[model samples]
Target: MSGDVRLEARGAAEETFVDTVHDLLDVLFERGSVGDDDQMLFRLAVSEVATNIVEHAQSREPIEIDFALTCDAEQLCAVFTDNADPALIDLENVGMPDADAESGRGLAIALAALDELTRRTEDGNTWILRRRRQPAA
Candidate 1:
């Protein structure tokens, strides 16, 4: 019950990006031995990340992102690699935005839901999200 699910979305709109992630998550949950709580939380984190990437990406050309999800007996992980310009994000400063804020809560929510979330921008932008699996009741 452990393998990988991958998808590539190019120039996708925010809605499309979320839909693509939903499709990938459907496949992952179906194939992996993930508990219901784990599946729900992971889905939320993944959707937030996908929406953030689609909404904030800056480039003259269409955006290109390679997304991968992997699961094993003990954990689940996701990686996102994108061709857009590197994003300057301060993860340490991420926090829930004000109540009136229309945006800015995605990273905070994602970070709170997952065991680990990291971003790298050396060659290109890469985001890694991981969570430890919970035992089924």
Candidate 2:
């Protein structure tokens, strides 16, 4: 594990998925030196993404979701993969939903909070969230 850490987990995309991933995150960050603001952003983005998968990822039975978290000197990165109906992912020109709206805002929140928020479809769906510790000079 040297100075870097990577964690991987897979479970049904149920209501408890967020908590499961977050517990791993808490341990990883505690061993490092992430600031409060960056930590908060990471937690918020991860929670939102996990919740979105639980609610929106098109599935009849509980689908399996894979997670990875990497922390190193340059940045902190998160990757999530799910065997969801890939057609439901829409990452183009996303906009925040109204305050009264219930859906369509999770991606927006993640995008606004993280340095990089990207999604791709391969064997399934993948979302990557990265935050840099130092600005480019």
Candidate 3:
């Protein structure tokens, strides 16, 4: 893995989420591995996963987020893992909200922002997000 960065935190979901994203972006920026568009997408995806952990994963023991970034032969990839229950989400049936709805849009936004998305349940839910970087011209 090329460009790997990992972060771990435990606290109120919102603060931890924000800190995690900021740290991830800081690493990307330091490596000059991301562009404006990539940064925006990362923000969107990170928010989506973090919100899911806060809202769906009911845990009083503080949420744990493990975030990693890496590069393979094909793309730059991000992986986020949490120990919260995976059963809270119905991935196949992500119901849409009304047009006037103010929330429930995060999953859709995350799906659209990433080039590849996958979820798996082992110990908990692991969200894998992949974005193919443009080849240098």
User: lDDT per residue, candidate 3, 1-119, as tens digits?
Assistant: 24444444444555557566667667664565556677678667766766776677755566676766665434656677777666466666665689999888888778788787788
| Residue pairs with clashing backbones, model 3 | none
Write down the lDDT that model 3 would get: 0.68
Please give the RMSD to the true structure for each candidate, in Å. Answer: 2.1, 2.7, 3.1
Cα lDDT of model 2 by residue, 1-137, tens digit = 24987888889988888889899889878865677777888888888988888878885655899999988877889999998877365667888988999778888888888899888888678989998765333
Q: Tell me the lDDT of model 3 at 92.
A: 66
Q: In candidate 1, which residue ranges exceed 4 Å CA deviation?
A: 2-14
Tell me how far the alpha carbon of residue 20 in candidate 3 is from the true structure, in angstroms, after superposition. 2.5
lDDT for 12 (candidate 2): 92
Model 3: weakest 10-residue lDDT segment is 1-10
Assess the local accuracy of residue 82 in candidate 2 as a C-alpha lDDT between 0 and 100: 90
Clashing pairs in 1: none
Clashing pairs in 2: none
lDDT of 1 at 70: 84
Model 2, position 99, has a per-residue lDDT of 90
